[model samples]
Target: MSSRHSRRSHGHSSGRNSRRTTQNTAQLIESLNTHRVNTLTELCRIERVAATASDEDQLAFQGPMTSAWTYYVTSNNLLSELRGLTRNYPFSSDALDDAKWRVSNDPESNRSWNYAWLVLIKMRDDQMVEAYAASEAAKPEMWGGRVPEAEEARQLAECFAWEWNEALEQMLRHWDTPPTTTGY
Candidate 1:
């Protein structure tokens, strides 16, 4: 019985394929780029807003600027670094153009991604936990009257929101140019 038990394999051969798929930095960035562009394009078409709205908005001063940084700072930082390395101090027109295309389509993808990262990093932050709790509490339907689903959702949202807010903060903090109050 002992010998038979020892012969029993812990995992099947197919289990080797059960490993989680991990994207390389470049691939990850590319995926994000695709998502951002698609999201922005759909959002613009759906909202009947111009694709250039993000461009027109000041990078430092505008609400969208804040919002953009608020969500996808890591993606922005990594891409910016890559661009700098490949194109020198001033980014090439082609790189800027590509970014513009993506930003135009999925303006908030950055935000969503950044928020998701933040949630993962600091799950125990009081503010985040509270926020998630609140959201979960709001989903009263999930509890069948006894459970506080909304509170649970709120907790989850809180975790994500912190990350997004941090990413935005990072972007604004590192911005070289002083935010222009005047129209750009």
Candidate 2:
């Protein structure tokens, strides 16, 4: 299976897209310009916020970074890495191999991608056993009540949280600068 998701080129069909461009993005860009901070400073601030946001915050930092890494890191290919490792909670050996292959050929892949891939390649043989075992660790039994279905879902969330958390940490640790522009 292909490890990468396809994206439409930004602002293709200019007239048609302009009619669709909402004020939100424009407003956000204007607001970002309103601040006097350098690009790196603002990016660092965003990384800090994304890393510690609550679940309800829609930032995913409390658990897995998942797609959130795209916001903090510049590489388009790193998304492929995360998508592979976290695919089905990140356990299939074949998928892991594909992820490593996908990232290894890209010279511009983010440093965090290399770090995360290194971390996962070591688990290729055992991640499956380890993940479900983690899922089992959170299952609680009760005397008179059935375990809630939410508990089951939480276990799945917990199953991949550690690996993704490490991924997020690597992103935060390796983030350096913005592209095509001076960091300041």
- Separately for all candidates shown, the number of backbone clashes (residues 3 or more apart, or on different chains) is 27, 0
Tens digits of lDDT, candidate 1, 106-156: 544344323322322233232333443344345555357655555575664
Which numbered prediction scores highest in TM-score against the true structure?
2
What are the models' TM-scores? 0.23, 0.24
lDDT of 2 by residue, 9-118 (tens): 33345555555443423343343344322233353454444434334442223223322233322343345545454565543344344545655564544444223433
Model 2 lDDT, full chain set: 0.41
The list of candidate 2 runs beyond 4 A from truth reads 1-76, 84-148, 176-184
TM-score of predicted model 2? 0.24
lDDT per model vs. reference: 0.36, 0.41
* Candidate 1 residue-wise lDDT at 100: 41
